[model samples]
Structures are given as C-alpha cells and as structure tokens.
Target: LHISSSWVRDSRFWKLVDQPAPKLESFSFVMERECDVEDNLTVLPRIFQDDMPKLRNLALVNVSSWPHNRFANLTRFSLEHQPPHIRPTFPEFLAFLAASPKLQELVL
Candidate 1:
C-alpha cells in the first residue's frame, strides 16, 4: 500500500486498510511525509498483524516508523528516506530486523 497522504484532515485511507484480507502475506508501504502523531502509526500493528503472519518482504520510503513494531514478519526490506541514510540510523534500522527474525536481505 502506497501511503502518499497524511490523515491530518481525515482518515479516509483507513477504510481501505480495514478490509479483512486473509491471503496477504507481504506488504510494501510508501509514505512521503513524516507525521509523528501517536495514532499516525498506531493503526499499523492492527492493520497488518492478522494478514502478515507469513509475510516475507516489506518496503518503506520517505516514511517514519515511530513504534516500528508493526512489521513482525518481514524477511526482506528496502527503504529510501529523505536523506536516504538517516531513516535507518535514527533507530538502527538493521537492528529493527528483530521484528523480522527471518530477514536475510537489507537494501538501503
């Protein structure tokens, strides 16, 4: 899911994420802006927790993972931040792989 807009005004996108998708195993989320509100990312853990049990790949660009716990099964990931390097460093993106304990590939 490419998250190109923020929920500052309203959470219209949340509706799309509410569907009960049982076959989804991988996800690619792209957010262009950074909004640090609590609820901003809080919706993630619930949105993906059910369908991502077998997920193996995940991608995030120009976004922020405040809690970062939503990705609990990713095995491959790619990220490109604004500066392109600091997003991973802000909180040890490599270490965050703990969420994806089976991860083997890390593409910056």
Candidate 2:
C-alpha cells in the first residue's frame, strides 16, 4: 500500500484500518502539511498489531510519530522529515535497528 496526501489535516489514517493486512509486503505513507497549519504532531496508532508478518519494506515521510511495534522482517526502512521532538532516541533507534537484522537499506 502506498499513500501520499498533500492536504492532510490530521494523522489518523492508520486508525481507520481496523483489520490486519496479512499479505501486505510494502507500505508507504507521505503526508505534506500545509504551510499555514500547525504541524501534525499526532502519534500514529499501532498498525495491525503483530499481524503483518510478511511486511518487508516500509517508508514514511513528514510523519511525527513512529509506531511502538517491532518489525522483525523489514528489509528496507525509511523515515524522513520527522520533527526533532518526536524522533526516536539513540538507544531506541539502535534497538529498532537491532530488531530488524535483515534490514538492507535504511534512511533517517
């Protein structure tokens, strides 16, 4: 699944997906905030819990919060344009990296 929205008002897109995506392999979301609006600082809801076992590639742009879940099978991961306050700490980032030993490409 790939989604790019240029006029997002809030960050609740993930919450609308109540069911798990069992066959999802790649997911990408990009939200371009309007200049006149306040930054979207909402943390995204945890996605699909532990049900996305086949997920491999993930990317997010202009997003404030990272989901508090482990993705052990990710081979490509990217995050961009995150606010400083919501960025993961070094230890937390390291742990995130540690969890995905099969990761081949990473972008921060």
Candidate 3:
C-alpha cells in the first residue's frame, strides 16, 4: 500500500484498519500539511500489534508519530520530514533497529 497526499490532517491520514497486514510486503505513506497549519502531533495507534510477519518494506514521510510495532522482517525502512519534537529517542530507534535483524536499508 502506498499513499501520498497534500494538505491532509494528521488524524485523517491515519485512519487505518485495526488488523494485521498478514500479506503486506510494502507500505508507504507520505502526507504534506499546509504551511500555515500548526503541528498537532498524534501517536500512531497500536493497530497491527506487531503481527506483520511478511512485511519487508516500510516508509513514512512527514509523519508526527511512530507506530508501536516491532517489525522483525523489515528489509527496508525509511522516515523523512518528521518534526524534531516527534523524532524517536536514541534508545527507541536502537530498539527498532535491534528488532529488525534482517533490515538492510534505512533512511532518515
């Protein structure tokens, strides 16, 4: 799944299904907010519960929050244009890297 939109609200861009993506191999979401709008950061809900066994690629742009899932099979992960306040802590980012042993590409 890939989504790219401009001038979208943080809430509206994240209304995803509350279920596992069992067969999903790649997922990317890019949202661009209007320049005049202030950031209303929101945490991504724990919908998948870290059960995406087959997921290999993940990317997000201009996202305010990180998901609470441990991706074990991800081969590529990318995060771009995130606000400084919403950036992951060092340990948190390390934990995510540690969880994905198979990760081969990472972009920030």
The RMSD of every model to the true structure, in order and in angstroms, is 5.1, 2.9, 3.0
lDDT of each: 0.55, 0.76, 0.73
lDDT of 2 by residue, 1-108 (tens): 887876544446645444587898998877766323336644455777667889999998877766776799999999987766678899999999999999999988
Worst 10 residues of 2 by lDDT: 34-43
Q: By descending lDDT, how would the candidates be arranged?
A: 2, 3, 1
Per-residue CA lDDT of model 3 for 1-108, tens digit only, reads: 887776444455445535667888998867655323335333455545566789899987776766778888999999877776668899988998999999999998
Which runs of model 1 end up more than 4 angstroms from their true locations? Answer: 1-10, 18-21, 32-46, 49-51, 70-72, 82-95
Residue 33 error, candidate 2, Å: 0.9
Q: Could you estimate the TM-score for every candidate?
A: 0.56, 0.81, 0.79
Error of 3 at 29 (Å): 1.1
Ranking by TM-score: 2, 3, 1
- What TM-score quantifies how close candidate 3 is to the native fold? 0.79
Q: Please give the lDDT score at residue 8 for candidate 2.
A: 46
Task: Output the TM-score of candidate 1.
Answer: 0.56
Give the residue spans of candidate 3 off by over 4 A: 6-15, 34-42
In candidate 1, position 6 carries an lDDT of: 43
lDDT of 2: 0.76
